[model samples]
Target: METIGKGGFCKVKEADVRVFRELLKKSTGERVEVTGMQHMAVKVFNRNVLKGQKTSEFDPFTGCLKMSDQLQSIMEEIKVWERNSNPNIVKIFKLYNDPTVPEMYLLMEKAQYGQIQIDLEGGDYLTKRNAEIEVVAVAKAGVHWPQGSGTDLEKASKWIFYQVAMAMEYLHSELKISHRDLKHQ
Candidate 1:
């Protein structure tokens, strides 16, 4: 699989659904057939990235030095997203937890577009995490309207805001998960 994107502790790769099915079949030795588009995103997380982080649960029998803040966040994300089945949320197809390896793969449905970004006024962008994507370009037909009227743009913006609000509400109210700092790419 080829890497499509990368974050602080994870690399997202484009994987085919058929390939994933074969992987599962090889591991479980059970024949499986899947009918769908052969497109998905697999997030690979390296557990050893934050190996030096210390925690309060340090002990001899069961160590706690690996229980870092980043690791905890990663685990929580997987737990929450894997259990949810909402229309506004991303669906987790499968979780490939390699017991012998130091990495984990989260197979999920791929979105049609890339990460959303806001173009800053001074052209510097908001912290440089996301690419400078023009709002006008994303708005599609909303930008082209009759002169002296901003109703279309306003409606489009409101629609986008509403979609985001719905996703947030699903995450917070239904899943009890606070999506903190969903940075752009």
Candidate 2:
């Protein structure tokens, strides 16, 4: 078996880098490089391409889907660790994709530290020790650090619930926007 790196997946090699670059070129038509060891997660979408006008794919009033819509949806989500703007939110960043390989590449901010995944099958899994370590690390990293240092279990849980509620409230009370998937990983 291959040795697992700190990121949990198999160690990423030079070939992996090449493949990723190729994918980006094919998808967004841009040549880019992975600048650092930080985790800059990239998400690619396989949305339809229409040459003409853009239109809403779904009805605004009713939450329904239609088969006859001319436009197709191809949206991808890429999240990166950003400098801390808020204590409650971990980190968020914006990315730009290569226009040529538009579907393939999204160059994003890199987060030096890894992420913690909460398995939903069981109860809360983050131990106090881990929380304490993360808190201290963030504290030492300084408050103004643009790419925030870290987040604890309590903050993450609260943020998730709040974000979900706000999203739901927005859907019901504000403009209609469809979110196809909402998975943690």
In order of appearance, the predictions have TM-scores of: 0.67, 0.33
Lowest-lDDT window of 10 residues in candidate 1?
129-138
lDDT tens string, model 1, 43-101?
A: 99886773444444344566544355666766767888887877656678666666688
RMSD of each: 6.8, 10.5
Q: How many backbone clashes does candidate 2 have?
A: 15
TM-score (C-alpha, index-matched) for candidate 1: 0.67
lDDT of 2 at 8: 17
- Judged by whole-model lDDT over C-alpha atoms, candidate 2 comes out at 0.39
Please tell me which predicted candidate would have the highest lDDT against the true structure: 1
- Residue 175 in candidate 1 has what lDDT? 87
Report lDDT (CA) for all predictions: 0.66, 0.39
Model 2: ten consecutive residues of lowest lDDT: 1-10
